[model samples]
Target: MNTDNGLAPLRHRNRWRFSGGTVDLHRPDLPARTATLGAEPAPVVLDPTRTAVIVVDLQNDFCAPDGWLAGIGVDVSVLAPAVDLSAQVVAAARAAGLPVIWLNWGNRPDQANLPPGVAHVYDPRGTGEGIGSRTAPSRAPVLTKDSWGAALTDGVGSAPGDLHVDKYRMSGFWDTPLDSVLRNLRVDTLVFAGVNSDQCVYATLVDAACLGYDVVLLTDASATTSPSYCHDATVYNVRQCYGFTASTPDLLDALAAARPLDAGHRTAPTTPKDSE
Candidate 1:
């Protein structure tokens, strides 16, 4: 199922199977009745049009080779696929006209209110520079704070129509304008992808679910310090506890299908005249 963009179609495996007192058959080719076995009707299909992709803290400190955690035994190799997936998701979202919000972490001059031992390990000021000093491009609408070592890196900037939100906690919505932004965008579903899957990503998903937003965790578009624990916990929580967990390819397919129909209505026809 190659999309128009030249990306291959998402791969789906059939899990359903047909079994009876005397007969058995593969699921995909089985008749609906045989497969259902007197079960209830099929589940309702969700409309992905109201979905938005929220990228959380894909920064130098977490994803790049010379990041703060680089020396802490963080295996960034797991992040390579995530970065590629993120790029694919972004491209698909932009093409389909869906919103792609990048939540970057930034720091202030004073490292006030930081978690104990965090400042010692990760230097906010470029002075004690570690491997993760490169920041996102200035063009991005960043949320700069000193509380957590999650600020957005340099070089990545927000585009003209993109929205930026700031936070001072693990959850992006904890003390930020995230809810308001989602409301304004009419976003009912959120696709999450970013760094530190076990910590920030998990926290955001839990919060998002609590706020009544349908969430999808892009398993391949996220990573953590300890690849084993981070990846395992993320998959477990998303699949069993929080919400739907999908691979980057599946997520891209869903987003591409939903974007065209949803994007047009979310934006205003004319730019508001603030008189510049």
Candidate 2:
């Protein structure tokens, strides 16, 4: 099945390969690498080849002690636990050959894209500390692109093959290429984990469900600096309304049980593919 010459197009759905004289658009014999998750809202199932883990806003601006939220006097301790847990879940997803996508809030320097309502969320009185007011303590403009605050939490590992999406709004799908990226990767199932369980993570999960992607949230790997009830409600809502919820440990066990070399481990691409 060496497709170096582009003779074999991986025989998978959504993977359109082009070669010297032609484009292979056939969906004749796609492979379904099914992996079962011991998820709540019933035992969830999916094709590992068509699944991806979307790690949302596990960034310093939200999880770090000196991050934007913390600097603004919010207790980031509650969100701190999501850092290592997200890393663990991401590692398992990578080993299983599932694509890992890091979706963080990387705002523009001028903040032209942000509307009045969105900007008002953090700086109610327009105190000049919200989205793009700058003057950050960490030297990196608060959540601005390529800043310290927007970078992934120190321990969370992202590889060369991992995809990174910068979101403008709370929902990653809004005004972002996230959905297109997932579709191009031939992914239909999204596994979610990140900080602020009631905010960005939940918003993105709900949007994903509406778009018809089978979503599964890793509860322990996603937390919030908000009240405990907010976190709990998000988990319950995801299982009851959006998609499904499962623990990180459970996902790891399921991934181990469904270890197939071609299901994103040995056979998955080492570099990002512009098109599948």
Candidate 3:
């Protein structure tokens, strides 16, 4: 079916061709491999040196067992697993000397810059009873924006080399400094992990892909208010539209494989006399 953007519908067609007791497509270049009887292959490899891991909106409202949304009937069971997987991904990226950018939803008290209809969906109470109060302790860079309940929740801080970019819309690229930050870091690939897979995460990935960055969504490192929505948005839509989706193990393997060998090179040691 067509989506809200009026895109064409997807079709499923199965055609069988046999030649010499083997199935083949019309094209000779098409291998004799079976098309519908095997498991899907792993995602493509992503170079760590040219990659940046973006942790988006992992605040208490979404990740914590008790937060504003906790009162709602929203299913949050996936938050813990997503958080755990994200931590592992972050560790791997750090080890590889890649940049880790944390995108938090920071809101202002006045709420002047929030998007037009955002606050209607998520109203911020006077007591900070919204998405802004949730925070993690990873010290990742944070961007605080007053657009909706978009401020990074409390308790999350920035690390030694993290960056925070404030945004005013669902996509991080809309009038934000995200592009400049990625360009400055020489990052050509984006590894996305975060909350609301169907909403913010989906928008960001689509925008990144449109901006020509190789995007990979850590499927296990992100979630939505509903499991079905998360799966459809992250696993299905991202794979079909924006980029590839991978689990933590799959991403770790890709990063490990992308590592460079030492080439058996060694550095010379300094003399003891020179120390004196």
**lDDT by residue for model 2 (1-276), tens:** 101121212223355555455676653233567678898889987787778999999887777777788787888787656788888888888787778888999998888888888889878887788876554556468878878788887778567567789998989998899998888777888999997789999999999999999999989999887888998999899988988999988888888887474544345432223233
Superposing every Cα of model 2 onto the true structure, what RMSD results? 5.9
lDDT of candidates 1 onward, in order: 0.57, 0.79, 0.59
lDDT string, candidate 3, 1-276, tens digits: 101122222111123346566655432111111111111234364455567899887765455544445544455666767777777787776555567777756655455676646654554454443333343222221223433233333333344455666555667787678998887666687988887777788788889999999887877788777657656646777777777777778777656655442222111222222212
User: Per TM-score, what order, best first?
Assistant: 2, 3, 1
lDDT of 2: 0.79
Clash number for candidate 2: 3
**Measured by TM-score, how close is model 3 to the native structure?**
0.66
lDDT value, residue 263 of candidate 1: 37
| TM-scores vs. true structure, each candidate | 0.65, 0.88, 0.66
> Could you give candidate 1's per-residue lDDT for residues 6-125 as a string of tens digits?
222211112323344433333222111100011112111344445678888776556655554554456766676777677777677656555767775654444364453544444546
* Model 1 weakest 10-residue run by lDDT: 31-40
Residue 217, candidate 1: C-alpha displacement in angstroms: 0.3
